[model samples]
Target: MECKNDYLCEKQINMDKLFEYSNRLIKETDTKFFRYMYDEINWKNRMIGLIGPRGVGKTTLVLQYIKQNLNPSETLYVTAEDFYFVDNRFTDLADTFVKYGGKYLFIDEIHYPNLNKIQTFPYNSLINSYSLSCQF
Candidate 1:
């Protein structure tokens, strides 16, 4: 099913634009910091967490990994604070994203309410619920 709200559509489109922009940002930046985390982190895991104070390069690392490791066509990167999600539910978004062949969901700002809640649910809930590898 598709969203009834047109604003959500526009926002989602912009979100896609953001992902493209993110890809360019990753490509343009100097990511030497990626050497340690890129090689060290087990990207094969179903769920991975990066915790640190603000201004750290966590988002850059995830975007770089997505750019280098995953299929850009099948992956999605959404920041939790997007106003689009205020009306568009995360569960519904996940349903639609996976329904459309979305494989990797890289969510930034996971400490936000919606994502933090997902973290509390059973591990299999995400993996089993949506055949998608989610990283926060």
Candidate 2:
């Protein structure tokens, strides 16, 4: 029981930090310059994949949408390269995020994570059941 409590406490702490980082990024984004495809891509879609060259504002576009639209607490923005991935699986993060009431998950640089982990059963099962709007 004590060990489980400690794990839960640690998870909450990590989530708090993740949300803080996400909010900071959203706050810093200026929606003034909208990307060309921003409007074309339907935000209503469950999974939105933005493919483009580097420095083309893919991350900025999603940040703008999250800032202008979604509730901060319900949405989480994480990059595949985030330090959390070092000790955690992507599916585990997704599961915990959902448990904490996360509705939208924006994983920038999605290609950076291990493809096998992202394609595993638990991850697929989570997305199928949850209202996840993943942006890669």
Top-lDDT structure, candidate number: 2
How well is each residue in 31-114 modelled by candidate 2, as lDDT tens digits?
A: 888877878979987776666566777888889999999999889998767798888877778888888878888877655333
lDDT (Cα, tens digit) per residue for candidate 1, span 1-136: 3556996676567556756755666567565556576688788887666666555777777777876777776777777666646776566556556755777776566454244446533243432111123742
Candidate lDDT values, in order: 0.61, 0.74
Candidate 2's TM-score reads 0.81
True-structure RMSD, every candidate:
5.7, 5.1
Clashing pairs in 1: none
